[model samples]
Target: MSEFRLDERLERDSDFLTKIGLCELRLMKDGRWPWLVLVPQRPDVSEVFDLTPLDQTMLTFETVLVTEALKTVTGATKINTGALGNIVRQLHVHVVARSEGDANWPGPVWGHGTAEPRSTEDTKALAARILDALKP
Candidate 1:
């Protein structure tokens, strides 16, 4: 069997955050919103259903864990979580902190505008805060 590997696109597009349980946590480079992606460390699994029952449950817990952490860190008006694999075939869940009057406002974040990448310092600070929040 092949070992698990992160999708190339995900690697290029996001910054690696701390790992939580069975998932590799990542911060989307776009600073437009407080966004995180959770990718299960499983080989060739392109959907949630592809994971074992145990893995699926762990993923759910991590999703909520990430969502709450992001909400607390960003103080967003709402948190959006989804597993839309339309563009990236790798099975990953997105936990986004949304606010009214943001770049996309009431619409979806996808394709709303060009991504404004975060500064290295800002990204490191944000990642640290999130990792701290994930601690038990």
Candidate 2:
């Protein structure tokens, strides 16, 4: 067994929000969209199928939980969920809130434009809102 560690690239691109069951829920720093990354706290796992059966179920449950919270907080028209590890080879799921007429409407958020990082105050406020929404 190995100790779990978040990939450096992910750590650089996102801010840690809170732990959600089997994963650490992080907020992407990009202000373009309300995005979250759920990284399973399991070492050496690069894909969802690599997780144990129980962990796989837990991951699915947490993903939905966070996604719902995001929708509630952002009032997004649609939610985009994905696990494309083409760049970062870590087992992480992305849950993004999308709305019509956004900067890149009817298209993917990735590679559309350079990411505009959120300010410190804005980030803190948004994180607080998300935390409040995640409460049971």
Best by TM-score: 2
Expressed as tens digits, the lDDT of each residue in 40-89 for candidate 1 is 99999998889999999999999999998998898999998888889999
**How does residue 27 of candidate 1 score in lDDT?**
95
Report the error of model 1 at residue 96, Å.
Answer: 0.4
Task: Count residue pairs with overlapping backbones in model 2.
Answer: 0
Q: How would you encode candidate 2's per-residue C-alpha lDDT over 1-136 as one tens digit per residue?
A: 6899999999999999999889999999899999999999999999889999999999999998898899999999999999999999998999999999997998998778888989999999999999999999
Q: For every model shown, what is its TM-score relative to the native structure?
A: 0.96, 0.97
Per-residue lDDT of 114 in model 2: 86
Q: Where does candidate 2 stray beyond 4 Å? A: none
Candidate lDDT scores, in order, read 0.91, 0.93
**Sliding window of 10 residues with minimal summed lDDT for model 2:** 109-118
